[model samples]
Target chain A: MPRVVVDVVLKPEISDPQGQAVLGALGRLGHRGVTGVRQGKHFVLDVEGTPDEAELREIAENLLANPVIEDVELHLSGD
Target chain B: MRIGVVTFPGSLDDVDAARAVRLAGGEVVPLWHADAELPAVDAVVLPGGFSYGDYLRAGAIAARQPLMRAVVDRAHAGMPVLGICNGFQVLCEAGLLPGALTRNSHLHFRNRDQALRVERADTAWTSSYAQGQTITVPVKNGEGRYVAADADLDRIEGEGRVVVRYAGGNPNGSSRDIAGVTSADGRVVGLMPHPEHAVEELTGPSVDGLGFFTSVLQGALSA
Candidate 1:
């Protein structure tokens, strides 16, 4: 009953045109104080066993995110 | 001279890929995603489409399928492989090639005849063309922007693994304007363009795409 959550985002150096478009839309809508925004992917995994950091990293590295253009962040709980 | 063409769940180009193979004077062997065996084929072609419904990223799911396992193994053993469009995504996801295809910079699903230069004609999939030759092929996809780490880009560029690049103009904002690449040994190649769709002048911009199929067939025969 262990749970793992992952967030994958484009590397900082890479341009995210979609994210920029969203930011522009937000500005157009008169949303105040939201200076910047970036878009990414999120995944929640319900694994059979307690997945250690390495296992979680392996999942993110191999499947959840592409290492070439995205960086992955992991959160584990419900141990 | 048998070539295997893998058809994933959402593949749209398998038939065209098979036809291209046949036109190139090679036998076509249809491969399924669930099959673990690759059968007896000199080379393999992973056709394109929204495999796995483009969920969890295009090509990520299809790359881990059983058929790709055998294909990847065979590719590593120096067998020739060509991945087109979504298949190119699968190849990169499987680590048979480098980089990844993200959503287009323009945020549009582009479909057009694209001009490309054969940067490395020595590759197995490009043997029919000369280096720096320009050819037209149809490119269609939403997630087709190729990206790689700076070091990786430099490495591939230095090794002459960038097999083809956008010639007339950059279509998808791919890094270094790269449209296709090959492995270190030039046995495995992946590209965003659908050469299968461009093999015939009747339905395509030109018959130039036929060369890729012919190149693979000749490479397999000579190997």
Candidate 2:
């Protein structure tokens, strides 16, 4: 089996309000070790037999994530 | 002249866009997002709404719609196109416009009458307004902050591509207080404000928004 994983995260230059809010909550809970947090999306795809990394990359860039404000990382594995 | 207004599943302002066209003395032609062929019209308007329920990202799915392909084709040929709110996001996602609209900086759904300064009035969609004119219109959205590369923003500012800039205060953390912008050719425009909602004074704060529709209508009819 072939599988591909995609991770989408906001660009570092852009502000992440959700992550900030989470950080504030964590502070209230006394989590002192964590300095910062960022929220992102993760996707896993099972391509059955052989998977084309180029095609999966295209889909992730075009539909799964917006490159203007996000960065995508693709990981492939075989089992 | 006839103007086409596109409607996606979650489109909330197609009726208001159509009404503005009528008020501007232009016949309205309804265009469905799923439809491949656009009706015979002088121009197209992508009204504001949560198209595809803003899935994955705002305007991401709707930008790939069949109707958008047709609109893009016409826009490239110099046909005027106006996109408001979510429609603006679609334009960016479709590559008809630059930059992207993301969540508001404060992460709140904002609805208010906002003041905007018309930066340029030479485009097909803003020929009726004078340069440096100020107008008030409704601005409402959950994710409307605009973002782009610094070089791109600088280039746009240098080329006079910015159409409108927010006045009084930065409403949504848009880069350089930009509220609207036009394509390099001045045919395609996208803005995150609801000008259609302000076309009628009784329904909105002011009727200043009518100029956008009238400008395009007159331009098309005269051409």
Candidate 3:
């Protein structure tokens, strides 16, 4: 099995609306001092069979990350 | 044509998306977030809804789902994929599309019939319409703001990747008023509006959204 690790990150300086809303709700609930929050996701895939890394990279590039706003880091585990 | 609509646990628009696909004359295959197969569908739709209950982030949790792996594979093979609303969030989160869907400038959840100009109708999912065509579709979301750096924004605009722009008003303060965009090859599209809800006249603000589904079907058949 080939393991693929994906790290998703938001662009710096982009305001996270969901994070802001949570911060506001937390403040209203009397929990202050939350400075800043940005949210993203990570995925680890263990493919059952070996696939071409170039093809997989194409997948990551086209369907995994939007090149305009998000950055994607791809790592292949277990050669 | 067989179109797959993925349903994450918290997804609210999968059924509607399937219905739209069926109405557009394609067989609908319901896909689950945990699945690893794409069900042999010619195209896929990552439907709207608060996937993973908007945990961590709006589309962040759902973006890591197992089915997304298969979607990534098929989409790379040039399978047509469309992301709507929260699905759009997942696309960005999954790194399929560019730009993040943040909160509205007014910081409110907005639900309204929005007018959008089809800026580029050459994409696989939008070729049925003409460029500069104005269509009304329902837009509903809290995190709908779209932003990118000036350079990337210029490149996206200059490369003709922008598919739709808010026509009447800047609903969510999206940079360049962009509401939707297509991939470089035009096979994958991500948009913030709820087009599935507008596929039928009786159930929607306009039947204009039928073109999106039909366009994909037509494109697939022609290809």
Candidate 4:
């Protein structure tokens, strides 16, 4: 079986308060080396055959992420 | 005039929106999200709610429903459509409007009587409001922050498509303090504030929200 991994993230210019809060917590926990954090969503889809990047891209653009404020990356692998 | 109020599975404000339409002297047509055929109605209102439990992004699932396709078709044909709160999110997702509503910058669920300045009073949903008039309405949401590319923001501002601007203070750090906007034809309006919840003075901060409901009737007559 093949799997498609989709990662959806907010655009670079968008403000991510959730990410900032995580970074704040990291700083408070003494992980001073980490300067920033951006939270996102990840989905792993198991398909019966080859994972089509184009089809996955369409799904990501239309459903997984909002293009106005978010970006998506797809990683494909098989077992 | 007959106004259709869509009741998605999680819709919580459809009743209030229907009541507001009836109060404004329009016949109420209750529409279900699964219904592909939109009944003959002069206008439509997408009331606010956690449709699809806000799954995979708020309003994203509901935007692709069958009824929304019918709505998209009618809206493009010049039918007046108003999307409130979560409905605003759906409108943006459905490409009927520009920009997207992101999480609040402060990361808090804000509920309050919000003051808004009417920026464009010529839209179908805002004709009753004088340009630059201030009105108070109830706004309650966690993901109501309006965001767009800097160029898009400037373009919308330059074109006078901005229908309302937040007054007094920014509630959710929306870019340019924009509270609402209208489509190019000014027939489609989407706002984060819940005007249906403020149509009655006894139950709301003011009856200022009634104008949004009434303005559509006037728009229909003149169109």
Candidate 5:
């Protein structure tokens, strides 16, 4: 069996308020040395056989991330 | 004139949109998300709601529905389409319109009476409004911030595709204070404000929103 992992994140220019909020909370909790923070989505997919790279890329591009404001990266691993 | 209002599983404003059409002297036709066939209607309105539970992304799931494919084809063929709130998200996701609606910068679910200035009046859904006319409508959303690449924004702005802009203050931090926009042919329009919710003075802040519904009906009359 194989697994595909997709990580989706907003473009660098796009602001991530959720990440900012988390950063603020970290500061309040006395955690230091953090320059900045950003948040995103991670999706894990399981397959019965070898995953087709093109199909996984298509799914990540069209469904997991919108190209307008977000970028996606896909990784495959075997169980 | 006959107008169709699409009702997705989580749609909350379809009834109000249909009522606005009837009040504007047009017939109302209910369209469902699963149905690919659209009835004989002069125009279509995609009302607001959290369709598909806003899963994966706002309007992303609903944008791929069977009916939206037909709507996209019709929109390209010059049929008038008005997308409000979530519907606006759907239009962007479906590629019927440009840009994408993202999470609000302020991180709040804002609901209020918003003021907007009509930027273009020749569009099918804005013909009733005068250029520069200011109107108030209800805007309620959690993810309504409009964003696009710099080049795309410049292109759309250069083409005068912007239909309306925020008048008093920026509500959701949309780029250039844009409240709404239209397709190149000016037939397909999408906005964050709830025009259908503001069509009746008795229930809404004012009757200013009626013009959106009436504008299409008037266009049908002349076409």
Candidate 6:
């Protein structure tokens, strides 16, 4: 089995509404001094067979990363 | 025809998606997120819902599901794939489509019947509709904002991959009012609206969403 790690990040300068909402709520709850908040996700997978880098890149381009406001970094392990 | 609906943990709309597939004159197959097989289905639907509870990010955790590998493979093989709402987010997360869905510009969870223009009706999922036709579909999500680089947006527009655009007003501040898009081959489509919820006239919206399912079916039969 091969492992694939996916790192997803929102682009800089783009407003994060969800993160801002959380920040606002936190401020209301008496937690202050939090200047910025941005949220993203990461995934590590174990798959059945070896996947070529090109195939993985295609996966990242087509299904794993939205080329619009997010960038995806895919690291293949144990290939 | 058999349509497969992939269910990730915390998926809220897979059942409805399956029902929509059945109503659209197709057999429904349930595919688990952990499974690698795509079943013997002619099409696939990545339905709406907060998969993995939107913990890491909306649709981000679910995008890495084991079954998604097969889904990506089959989708690239020209199998028609539709992603609605959260499914759309998953599509973006999985890199099946361009643009990332962010929080609503107003910083709220928007749920409403939105009017959208069918920008490109030639795709497998939208061929039944006329280009520039307006349709209403329900959109509900906290992270439905769509954003992309200007160049990428221009390229998508240039390539005619943009399938739908918000009509009256930008609901979630999507770039260029883009509500839906198709792959280069027009086989895979992802949209930020719940078309399945608006399929029936009794559901309060126009029965325009049914065209998506019908179009895919017709396209499959024709091919």
**In candidate 4, what are the lDDT values of residues B78-191, reduced to their tens digit?**
999999999999999999999999999999999999999999999999999999999999999999999998888999899888999999999999999999999999999999
* Cα-based lDDT for every prediction: 0.90, 0.91, 0.84, 0.93, 0.91, 0.84
Cα lDDT for residue B221, candidate 2: 69
Q: Give the docking tier of candidate 2.
A: medium
DockQ, cand. 6: 0.37
Report the C-alpha displacement of residue B138, candidate 5, in angstroms.
0.7
Q: After superposition, how far is residue B86 of candidate 5 from its true place, in Å?
A: 0.3
Off by over 4 Å in 1: A48-51
Candidate 3 lDDT by residue in tens digits, B42-152: 888999999877865678778878899789777888999999998888877877777677768778788999999998888989988999999999999887888888887
Candidate 4's C-alpha runs over 4 A off are: none
Model 3 chain B: weakest 10-residue lDDT segment is B94-103
Which runs in model 5 stand beyond 4 Å of their true positions? none
Pairs of residues at least 3 apart in sequence or in different chains that clash in candidate 6: A62-B95, A62-B96, A63-B94, A63-B95, A63-B96, A64-B94, A64-B95, A65-B95
Error of 4 at B56 (Å): 0.9
Which parts of model 2 are misplaced by more than 4 Å? none
TM-score of chain A of each: 0.88, 0.92, 0.63, 0.92, 0.93, 0.68
Better of 2 and 5 by TM-score: 5
Off by over 4 Å in 3: A1-12, A15-79
Which is the better candidate, 4 or 5, if ranked by lDDT? 4
Highest TM-score: give the candidate number: 4
lDDT order, best first, reads: 4, 5, 2, 1, 3, 6
Model 3 docking tier (incorrect/acceptable/medium/high):
acceptable
Would you give the TM-score of chain B in model 1? Answer: 0.98
| Candidate 5 chain B, run of 10 with poorest lDDT | B35-44
Give the alpha carbon lDDT tens digit for every residue of B1-223 in model 5: 8888999989999999999999999999999999978878888999999999999999998999999999998899999999999999999999889999998888899999999999999999999999999999999999999888788889989999899998888888889898889999999999999999888878999999999999998888888
Q: How far in Å is the alpha carbon of B215 misplaced in model 3?
A: 0.3
Model 6 captures what fraction of native contacts?
0.68
